[model samples]
Target: MRLRKPKKEWRHRKQRRVRITAMIRKELDWIVHDKISMFILFFLPIFLIISVGNVEFNIDSRAQDTVVYVIDLDSSEYSLDYIETIRGENFTFTVYDNHENPDLVTMENAEALIPTTELGAYLIIPSNFSETLLENQTAKIDLYIDGINTIEMLVIKYQFISANLLYQVEYQVFNSEVLYIPEYRPEIDRSILENAVPNMIPTILYAVSNMVACQAIVADDPLKRMLLSPTRKGEVIQAKTFAYIFFGALLSLVCMCVLTFGFGIYFISPLDTFLIFWMTTIFGVTFGLFFSSLASSRLQGAQLFLFSFIFQQMLVNNLRIEPIVNYMPIEVIRQNITDIVYRGIPFLSLGNQIALIAGMNLVALGAAWLSLSLKKEVA
Candidate 1:
């Protein structure tokens, strides 16, 4: 009786161990098979970080090259010295001397030139600029900014204030009685939200391509059946690629129209802006395909895409990773587009960007094609 009881107890213990192992294996299988579970566990964190916490990552490297114009209404020696001090290594200034180009120095002219010039902002020195500092100890300056170039406007404003403060410090050190005070008057009233939409276009397109095109082909029942059919795999891949590009282009056009017509976000070169955005759409499509090819499942592909997109944005605009900036495809495209639309730079300047994006697309397409297996006819 004692030997039989020991044998039953061992059997019970063995059954319990088997059940526990099976439960763990079942959970692993579920995590692999369930797309929603995979996204929640892996991809949601990236999305939340990019979308919600992006306020901390709004830095732009391009702001360093921002240019502004200075209209010296008070063409005194003091004003010219002040203007010279402003033309430091940090920013470039286009000086319009009131004495030389008196016709272009009016307040009305400045307002009209705002729309026609590539200058982000312009400063007007009052006629009492030199006299005020030598007598009243206060100099007033007018700052007129293009409502479109928000980033450059802020940078120029900060640099202008810093330059004036430095000048004050130098004078105070030379003679304790001399006081230099500057008052700035802003001409345009605008908000940061006005330019946010145009800036976010690339990220929006990337997310769209990942969800609509890349995941659609693998997750849809009909597409999966086609993948298992006698269709030429290359042709199928081309069709999907074209569809995604078309959809992305359409979305970009719609967003641009809304920005141009509805809200009046300035696009100096409309054709250049449109073409560059279309090229970025191609980049987004290729990036989605690359992620899909590299990942094992649809959810995993989206997770990879989101992760890469966020990292690329940080590398290009938010962070100062110069060595890796040249290697990131979307970063190149975004920088070129920003120059074209915001800085009024010509499209021909984007020759390197065009070549780099083309190379990246070819590599991504080749990888995607190689990853997919075609169904062979059975004997």
Candidate 2:
């Protein structure tokens, strides 16, 4: 009888210990074992290196790829060759022949076209361009560029000067005692509010979508409660995902409408813009869910989002980070989306980006499923 009692007592104590250990584990999970902390510990340093810290993360790295117009007065072969040489990879050039399109050369027409065209710069080849280069010993090309973005203006300026210099070298104009000087008279676009609206749209979308992505799952107490019902955990997660997608689409639409109508932001293709925004929202939602699955609380999810955003901002276009940075969801979104909206590129052309987004969603969904399964086991 004594042996039996002692064995029973020992079994009870062992059971109690097991329960205590499990409880401790749960509490620890709620307190510290979270996605945010994991990233902070393991990946924070990498992100910091890429971002150069907060100081450089939010800097506007957005550059506008625009179109430049040209008016050719000299029909000489030299003038044509110079024009062809000045056409850059960063921008497209459209030559408007004044003789063929006389109505398009008026001051009134130019001023009207300023608002309508996405013209970054304009060039006028003087009538005596070839004559000046060969005989008069002076090549002065007139250029008027949009100076809204100083950096872009500088790029335009350098491209023109470099092209002219190359032309001089190729034609031996400089050696012929001719000064190949290019005159650039820049016109700063004073429509700051109008010009700034397009630049701001992507950042605004990213910020809003990031918040939505960071909290779509973690803050839902109702999702946790749903587990107590007869519903499977996968079903509950599916519902939450559907909600995020729907709400994300709705929110993105609202933002686009406000910008297009209220703020006068010009989107060349509304359908393309809408589709990109919707897809971006979907991407953001998945991003949040993936982290939230690994996170114990809403704050942790937010931290994850912040780390992601900073890494994206700092690492994008930085050759030091290269290939890996190119694969980031935010970078992909910014590149493809801005190309469509700002550069007027075709949406269908982004085959790689489209595939990448789909792949990311699959990965996120898998992560979310695994996380929910683990949570169920713990409960």
> Highest TM-score, which number?
1
Q: Which ten residues in a row have the lowest lDDT in candidate 2?
A: 53-62
Question: What is candidate 2's local distance difference test score?
Answer: 0.62
Residues 211-270 of candidate 1 have per-residue lDDT tens digits of 544553454334455445334455455655765666556656765675666555778888
**Candidate 2 wrongly placed segments (more than 4 Å):** 1-200, 317-320, 342-344, 376-379
Candidate lDDT (C-alpha), each: 0.61, 0.62
What does candidate 2 score on TM? 0.48
Q: Write the per-residue lDDT of candidate 2 for residues 1-379, one digit (tens) a residue.
A: 3544345442465654544444334433432444653343224323432333232223323323455556778878888777667654433345554455677664455555654446667677888998987774777777887766677677667767677777777666665465645664554332343444334445545555555556645765565654564445555456556655665566567766655565456777878888787787677667677777767787787898888766666776454386787787667777677668756787778988888888988888788878868874311
